[model samples]
Target chain A: MENQPILSVRNLTKKFGGLTAVNNVDLDIYPGEVVALLGDNGAGKSTLIKCVSGVHSPTSGRVTFQGEDVNFSNPIEARDRGIETIYQDLALANNLDVAGNIFLGREKEKSYLGGLIRSLDDKFMRDRSAEALESLHVEIPSLKAPIETLSGGQRQAVAIARAVYWDAKLMIMDEPTNNLGVPEQKKVLELINALRDRGVPVILISHNLPDVFAVADRLVVMHRGQKVTEKKISDTNSEEVVQYMVGALDDTRKAEVVG
Target chain B: MTDGATKNIKEPGKNASKTILLSLMQVWAWVFLACLVLAFIVAVPLVSGSSVSFLSVRNSQNILVAITPVLLLGLGQTFVIISGGIDLSVGWVMSFASVISALALRGAFNAGLPLPLAVLAGLAMAVVGCGMIGLFNGVIIAKLKVPPFIVTLGTSFIVRGMALLMSENTTVIGLPRGVRNYGNESMMYYVRGDGGGFYFFQKPELTVELLRRMDRIITYPVLMTALVVAVAIYALKRTKFGRYTYAIGGNEVAAVRAGVPVERHIIKLYVLSSVTAGIAGFLSMLRFTAGSAVIGDPLLLSSIAAVIIGGVSLFGGSGTVVGTVIGALIIAVLTTGLVMLNVPSFWQFIVVGAVVILAVLIDQTRDIIKNKIGSS
Candidate 1:
């Protein structure tokens, strides 16, 4: 029972008109584990996570989160149910401030006399958002400037902090360390390890093998929209994982191609 | 160096400079607009040899009074403009409202309803009618995903044609006195003469006539314009709807990912724009005492010009209604100033065009300067 996955997927599939972006893949994430998904470009890593995070609807599949079967129509629905996705671009409005980006749709409202006049409780949101950033060890000098001014790594940290602040039980970070410089990249890797230590499950999808090896407990590799292999970091090396991701026709995929 | 020490050495200085730069950009737009208004006020008196006393109470009241309808339309235009959209048809929509409301009130009074109630009904009908046109503009722009410029421009022509068809291109007259009074009413502080009299054109000035002249003070239309601007400021600055509007305008895809109902907010924005146009029309109809299909013809260009000149970006997402109101003043006062100084009427258009270009030029320059600073 202790080894059971916290979130389970059964034969998840997603298609865009004539093409199936993600084809019949089953994956699971357990609490206190960092599962790294490895794939080349267009290998459906993002699509599979989008389906689970409610950015896209699956064609046919079952997603069981924390032991309950659920369907999320949008990100808001997925977020409410304790699943959060931080896309590659971070999906933050550049015109708004740090607190605003964090609580864009979920603003705290002030209520009077049993919920009469409800306006944004701006002071509360500002203070709490500062607290949230502090918890994640993100040191933004000002919370009032637009998010666009922040460095790439700082932006990534804010995105991660927003998810954590919302009580996300499972974070699907797509390309979390894609374009960061060495120092920033190191900070993000440290952040992931810190998140894992706090007992939150993370599904890190990236091509950066060293970073994956540094944090991920389990590695799930996909190729041509199909799961090629799954391995524990202790059992295999990054050199072996690349063989599965490169579509070198790992024995399992070759079986499907031939049969 | 240790990793922890390296992390401790953060770039707080760069962040502090950026904060100052960002705040400056926001405040500069308004400061620049105020300077434009001030420059005009000061220059007209010096340049025109007092043909226009640019800052006199009566003259200030005149500019405010004349700009009432314009300021109203400018408020709505600010909303549309801020949301990364433009509504070109608002001018004709106003004309449509004026014609419809004028016809309704006159007909209602003729049909034996009390004059005040009939006037109220007519105003209500005008607002409702214009709001519908806005809704039509909204549906096509939001759902059909047509560009706002084309959708609103096409809708403006259709509404203009409808207003003409409603009156057969005639100017409706004999409006109810109450409706007309709304256009004409004003408040005044009577400056009682201290028994001083002067001769004018070889005749002695009578104190009774002087008191009567003093009795007429400031007009109510200025106050009305102030109220509209105030309400617009409140709506855009102090509400949830406004925040969502800015978010959508700034980055539509980001707003959607954050769960803001983008299409719905945009539709409401269009409606707000048209309803204000309708209100402006009612004001103009009262002031002019006639509602013609062509009454709104000049308003479209003036209001849009005012908005752009006020520093509201055509690209959307960064401007204030307060800036917009000042833009309206600049245009209205310039027109009045030119006419008073006996400048050719056609020259007014050229100056307005030049001012619009200048405002945009300033905006782009500010952006470039900030970018240079950012990189350095």
Candidate 2:
């Protein structure tokens, strides 16, 4: 309880013209904990995370990461600062192989001709990618197979492997279990637990209540662009969470603002 | 985890063989090319009887020379197409380069510059001028977020007009005599004179005996083309720049998310295409010893056709420079072979069009097969 929060969002607000996507949401993520952000469709879960992950600029608020004020202009800046977001789309280039995607933006290169020519170090990258995937107990027949040829679960594993390889301080996953087979969904939850054990704070966004109950230490529920409730895992069950998700319950009784 | 473990125990061998088969399918362009050569060898002799030879070394050299311009343009187009873009301006950019290089050479000669310097100036002017045109295309296409087809198409017209106006809609001639010799000169020439030695770096007068004896004639342009092709193949396959290109083509959003400089990379791809076009333009001028504004006009589609036939998908994200080489060779051989068999020139279009369609059909089949394998 005495540890300083690794990530703190103070009074964050984001609007798309007249439609306010995320409204004055303040949250803190401590190390080694999985905080599940649960909400219905268009409930602003994605917008709030996007603001923190640098996909979109917040209209008003301050994001403090690791005890420093931070505002990132793009996803790359956030990534460089050790914040990795696995988007809903998975954001993998289908044409590139598993190893290639693992080393996508930051590729290892060997220079020749006194640095006049630089070439991708495919052997080194492939070996490293293989090690990373192996550590995660993820298996694909070939590291050289393009991502598009991999199963959905395999692609998701590759995305997670990339984040793991980069040594992310914080992991943000949007709908990590969506469209995945049951066992694949189980693997992802286990991955979240594994990441938490490694002292990496994870912000998990999901519609699946069982997934939230199974792994998260705390739950933050948002409804109609505002935080509806925050609860510890022991204090709340799925039915109560669903009630909050459907806006049947409001923790902040600002009645006039309730949609 | 257990499912994966079980699958892994059984799937590796199956997966490896399936992947190999898939890659073989992707390389159908090479197989098609070999078949075309074989067909020509078998068919040409039967059609022409004793008058023509399709498998002769001389004819092979001629085919190589003929493929030079198309292959160069196709090499450039291969990059653009693999990056999920098309550069319509390349044809006119080539025309522009030819015209500009010719005019610059003539002016350099008029200014009494030495032949080597004049040639260098002409080559530099052509490359730089066309590169600027490519830069312009890249800016609008990448920064301005204009679609490549529309932007390049617009530039193609402007460049075509500029080429016409600059050359006065005529062939720009009056190049120095050495320019002609430089274009025609070979790396080595064999002469059956007194013990038959090889002539190195010299363009001797062709007597009947020398012509008959000159079996190994490797032109300067051919060697230059080979070097260019080699460098291009290496760049596309081995460099990070090449990886970014494929990534951008595969999924631009994903590439951006991965921290790739997508805009800058796209610009580089367009520049690469234009530079190749520029080189093609300069080489064509040398081959003819004259530069005409319209020299590359008819070649635009053929170059694209070669890329298509070589298995570079118009949708982008997958291709190889070696495939483009095979593609160019296929077109060149088809045209040359048909001519040798006394088929009318119009038939070349029919044959090439059919081959292009066939290539696309094969590409689609590859996709369907890959999907099946991937899903399984």
Candidate 3:
């Protein structure tokens, strides 16, 4: 029961007009694990998880969450089932404050009997968001500050805190630390480790081998929309992951596919 | 902050100055509008001459009356603009409303309907006309996902043309006295000059007869206009719909991803804008005792201009109705001041156009400063 996968994707494929972006990729994400999805640009790693997170529907495939086959038309529907996707853009409203952005769609309203009007309980949301950040040890300058005013690391922290607070069972983060400074990168890796400590399943899509090997329990490589290799982080080295990433693994098979 | 500098606040003096200047820019949104008001107060008197006080009670009334329709239309545009869209048809929607009410009142008056009943019918007709246009705009823009500029522009022309055709390109005049009374009736009156111990800021206690003898007066319609502005400001700051407007306008895609019903909210915003147009029409028709197909044409761009000057971003996410009210008032002041200064009415065009451009320039400069501060 402890080893069972929390999320499983079978034969997932996504086609954009003529080209197949994700072709027959399969992944099993177990609870309490950080599975690093490593690939070169356009290797279909991002597209595969976007499918699982409901950013895009699979062209032809199946996704099972907690043993139930599901298809969500949008991120909102998937979020209802405890699947959250943190896009590369972060997707935070720049005009809204940190608390407003966090509780945007799922706002908390004051409930004191019934009334004709329902409004956001500002103090409640702000306090809780403060708590959310504090728990993750992420120090934001101000909860009332416009999100655009924050640093790159701060913005990423806000996004992750939102996902964590929503009770997300499976989280798909696309390059969580891209463009972040060295210290900021360390903070993100610590967050990934913390998620593992809480027994939450995380799918980290990254190109940085150092960051990937630091937190990921298993490493999965994809090339040209196909899964090239999968190995436990302890069972493989950075050199092996690189070979699979650049399509340097299994020379005979690569020649046959190319020809 | 560097690790060594973290313990010393003075080490980041440059960064501290940037924050100071950065926050000053944020405060400029309100100060910009205030400066416009101050300009109205200072320059109106400067250019208009000492004998003709621009701050006179009667002139204030005139300013309020002039800006009522602009403010009414502006309130609607503020909602739509905040949601990352614009209603170019609003000015035409007001004309459409005016015609509907006037024609309905005429029909009832001719058919021997009672005066009160005729007025009610006219108001009903205006409401229904505004509702229908709003729904049409909403459906095309929200459901069909058409760009709002194109959709509203097309509708503006169509509605204005329909008004022209229906009115035979002439004025819909001769509205019933009952319908006109509610709009034109002065709710209260004040003494007409700057006298009887009635200084601009002084409130003197006078006998009833003395009050009656006072020559200067401020009218009820002006008070009602302020009432509308006050209510709109309140609703915007304290309601769920208010926050959603900013949310929707700031980043629509983010709003959608967060589960906001972006399409439905936008539809409601259009509906609200048209209702204000309907009200403006009813009142304007009463004031004029007639309506023409071209009544709202010039106001289309002017009302949008008022909003932009008020500090609401043309880009759609960040602004307040309070700013918009101030904006409409500035145009009223600018136009009224220029006219009193004996500027040619046609050249008022260049003056007003220049102000709009100046406003856009200021908005852009503030944004540039903000981005520099943010990146720095």
Candidate 4:
């Protein structure tokens, strides 16, 4: 899993007409490693992630996955390529149950008479969904309970489990623990660590320095849509990372200072 | 783990019972149940002192015939409302369908066409015409990004004006005997004895008789309503399309992110809704044997009211087809019962208005309860 980087972004830049939201960012994420992206508000972290996740096309440069330069026109295409984004909203329908939300768009069905009519096999979906949740160690009370009834942490777990069940290779989580309490945050961090142990490349976007320091193997700092600095978590301190995030350190300053 | 799983199953059962009881106590359920009771109460008085004769049967058949088309139209409205849209144009579409089919039949029958072919032509015209209007509504809403309410409201005027123009604001009658018999012919065949004894059954009294009686009681509209309900339930519960509908209704942004063809689904909903309205129109013509420009006047409010009463949320993503059917039946029973009780025609409006308000209140209460449970 650590032999090579699974996803490589080279000189990727995104501009919204007059505003350059993301500028010339290069990142390499390897399998079984956690990369934390940290920035203040409007720091282009979301824009950069959106470019990679196919929510928005990069204005310049390219995203290479498995050594192939690829462009995604939509989220579905991006998801089809084993890149899944877990947005902060979780994007789950509250009215639907766990199984229903898990298989929202891509539902499995049994066909009668050589595929003339398709029928939903509820039993199969329920069993498979239970297996998926169990694999993630998410102890959901029932598959029939609507997601709205689940705790915040459980909802986040379900969203993560859905991505894992779909065989996502590169998982991008945006502020996954922002709204969670201390214990829930601990649960999600553990889930992220578990994901890494399973050889899934995880890109964590967070503002909590302690959270990043706890789990991230590498840190990428972006300021004003540009990659200000990149550092291995072992070699860098929170003060140095904060300096890069607030534009207090430039390339020259970075060279003068050794971590 | 075993204890956890046991609690899981047991808790939902307990919650479901509570929910069912809560739903029973809902104002809509009470109103609907009360209407059924009122129907029986009125029936007793209306038939009192009159021979316990075939008159009751005939009246029941008449009520069914009148209600069938409304039921079909209401079913279509239920789908639209469940998806978080409205279709005021259904009534106009129904009128247009009937008028166009009547005109087509008059021309085709005169040209020595077979009766079945003529009937098919009438149905096709209605379906195509109403379906096109629905498609137009979908296009305006999805492509042009117009709110469904404004688009459908605008379409209602356009369709009504078109129907008026087509019919020249006049009644079109003189449909052939075959078409007339579809609604006019007695569904039941009875054997009468000279001792004032009558044996009421069906045409064959064996296979065809039961089938025929069922057909009469059921009617094509009733059967179509049932089919619509079944299809809707299956789609909403089982199909990917149904899932997407709920998803989109729940959150359009999330649905789009999940790769749902949001625009396409919304368009299809509108088109199917109109198609149902068209079928309802043809059924109305079959029952009445005439197509007037104003044949669908009573349908607009009734259909919307039925769906609302059936537990469909005005804001999409919730409700069931069964709920809508119950709603339509409630309206049908109430209207019939009131007429039997010799209630003033104007007073029926007050009754319906009160019921609609009560249904909406129940819906809001249910929503609040669901949210409270969810949040907890």
* Candidate No. with top DockQ: 2
- The list of candidate 3 runs beyond 4 A from truth reads A13-24, A59-61, A111-114, A250-259, B1-51, B108-117, B192-224
The 10-residue segment of model 1 chain B with minimum total lDDT is B1-10
Per-candidate interface C-alpha RMSD?
3.7, 2.1, 4.6, 4.2
Position B111, candidate 3: lDDT:
98
By DockQ, the better pick of 1 and 4 is 4
- RMSD per candidate (Å) reads 4.6, 2.7, 4.7, 4.1
User: Could you tell me the TM-score of chain A in candidate 3?
Assistant: 0.92
For residues B1-376, what per-residue lDDT tens digits would candidate 1 score against the true structure? Answer: 1242113244668667665765676566566556756776777777778665666555666777778888788888899988899999888998999899888878888999997788777789888999899999999999999999999999988998999999788998887666656666554443444753333222233567664534333455566667878877866775667778778878888788878888988999999999998988877877887787887778788888888888788888777888888788788877887776678999999998998998888778777766655445
RMSD of 2: 2.7
Cα lDDT tens digits, model 4, B1-376, are: 2222112223465467557756665555645666575556647565653443223555566566666667777777776776677788888888888898788877788788998888788888888888889889999998899998899889989988998998888888888878876655454444333322223334344454343333244555555656766887787777777777777777777777777788998998899888888888887787677777787857878888878888888898787777777777777767766766667778878888888898888778776776654454
lDDT of 2 by residue, A1-259 (tens): 4389999999999999999999999999999999999999999999999898898999999999999999999889999999999988999999999888999999999999999999999999999999888877788878887888777778888998899999999999988999998877887887787788778899999999999999999999999999999999999899999999999998876555774
Q: Provide the lowest-lDDT 10-residue window in model 4 chain B.
A: B1-10
Query: In every candidate, how many clashes are there?
Result: 3, 0, 8, 0
Q: Fraction of true contacts kept, per model?
A: 0.36, 0.68, 0.48, 0.44
- Model 3 compared with the native: what TM-score? 0.88
Candidate 4 per-residue lDDT, tens place, A38-147, comes to: 98899999999999998899999989997789999888999999999999998888777887877777878988899977877778778888988887777887688667
Q: What local lDDT score does residue A104 receive in model 4, on the 0 to 100 scale?
A: 76
Two-chain DockQ for model 4: 0.49
Chain A TM-scores, one per candidate? 0.91, 0.95, 0.92, 0.95
